[model samples]
Target: MPQPRSHDIRRGRYSEAGRSYLLTTVTHQRRSLFHDFHHARLVIQQLRRCELERSCRSLAWVVMPDHVHWLIELKALPLGEVMRRFKARSSLALHRAGVPSQRVWQAGYHDRALRREEDVLHVARYIVANPVRAGLVRSVREYSHWDAVWL
Candidate 1:
């Protein structure tokens, strides 16, 4: 097996408007930065901003200690642009919140475009269940950093 090249990340990628995608982006060096409530809320604010600006409709999202899992329906922009803006804005927000790290996120994100027949609710359940799966919380209800439209 061959290792994937960095440029291959975007190979054959297409961003169709109105399509749902699950995006995961990790913090730089996978540092558990979201452990602090304020730091985590800052990132959450950026997610809300993306929706408010009509970039994407957030179906579900969970701000884990070191990464974020967001299920969103692409709106007006391409997936790359939406992610670029989100990362930039979130980095700025973290800086403004007194987080000294200049680099908040890793270079790129992972996105899974959902097929029309896929069960969106099932996917959302899996997303919200991340905290429980990671053993950070006993139940989804106990996780403070996650949300889903169905829940």
Candidate 2:
């Protein structure tokens, strides 16, 4: 049997308002475009912009070299729409900032909706600790591109 395409895999996925989700998306070809501080900030700007627009409430986020992990509580929009807006806006921001990548993000993102019984704080910590786990910093505090509400 053949494997499902990315979109196909998400066909049955549903989004619920007021639910928290952990989202991950990669840069085109995993090019590490975010290694540049300014470029990374552009992406972060978009994340904040999305929140201000009330698409979702950002709980935690980390901008890695080639990817991003975001924990958010869905607001008015569905998960797919929220991610769509974020990726599109961030890609435009990267272009305006003079980044070379025409496609700032891959076609789709991965999302896991948090269950009520889950420890949200634990998940937030895991998201912010990505840089430490990746060896980019000796400690999470040493990394500058991550944020969490609990911190």
Candidate 3:
């Protein structure tokens, strides 16, 4: 299969600071690397670190077996940059932590920018309820790798 060009992958996409976005990205080849609890926790740490680094405020997130969904309010950086750094940092940390991977994530990610009037809490609920929707768990409380401020 031919790999997509980077420019084509990011075309028609624009990132602005201070906007809330829901981002989703998969692992390389959709590997179930996050099935391990510790590895998934590492990703959660990096998600919070992105907030600590002033890139974005993590509103909600979930770590599935092969992908992640992150809802964040951007601080002063482009969403693309924030994601780039977040992925890179997490990949590095995971490697250093003795987690084996040829690559930590796929190159492109999906982002949906929220309008001012949109219900953020609704989105947060959707994010945290992914496990239930995926049949991974019977209840949100049973999911070990998801979080939302409202929950």
Best by TM-score: 2
Q: Which residue pairs come into collision in candidate 1?
A: none
Error of 1 at 61 (Å): 0.4
TM-score of 2: 0.95
Among residues 3 or more apart in sequence or in different chains, the pairs in candidate 2 whose N, CA or C atoms overlap within 3 Å are none
**Weakest ten-residue segment in model 3 by summed lDDT:** 3-12
lDDT of 3 by residue, 29-148 (tens): 899989999999999999999999998888999999999999998897888899899899889988988877589898888889999999999999998989899999999889899887
TM-score of each: 0.94, 0.95, 0.93
Q: For residues 33-143, what per-residue lDDT tens digits would candidate 2 score against the true structure?
A: 999999899999999998999989999999999999999999999899999999998998888889875788888889899999999999999999899999999998898
Tens digit of lDDT per residue, candidate 1, span 1-151?
9964746788888999999999999999898999999999989999999999998999999999999999999999999999999899989988888888668998888999999999999999999999999999898888899888775
Q: Whole-model Cα lDDT per candidate?
A: 0.92, 0.92, 0.89
- Residue 86, model 1: lDDT of 89
Two-way lDDT contest, 1 vs 2, winner: 1
Candidate 3: where are CA atoms >4 Å away?
Answer: none
Model 2 has an lDDT value of 0.92
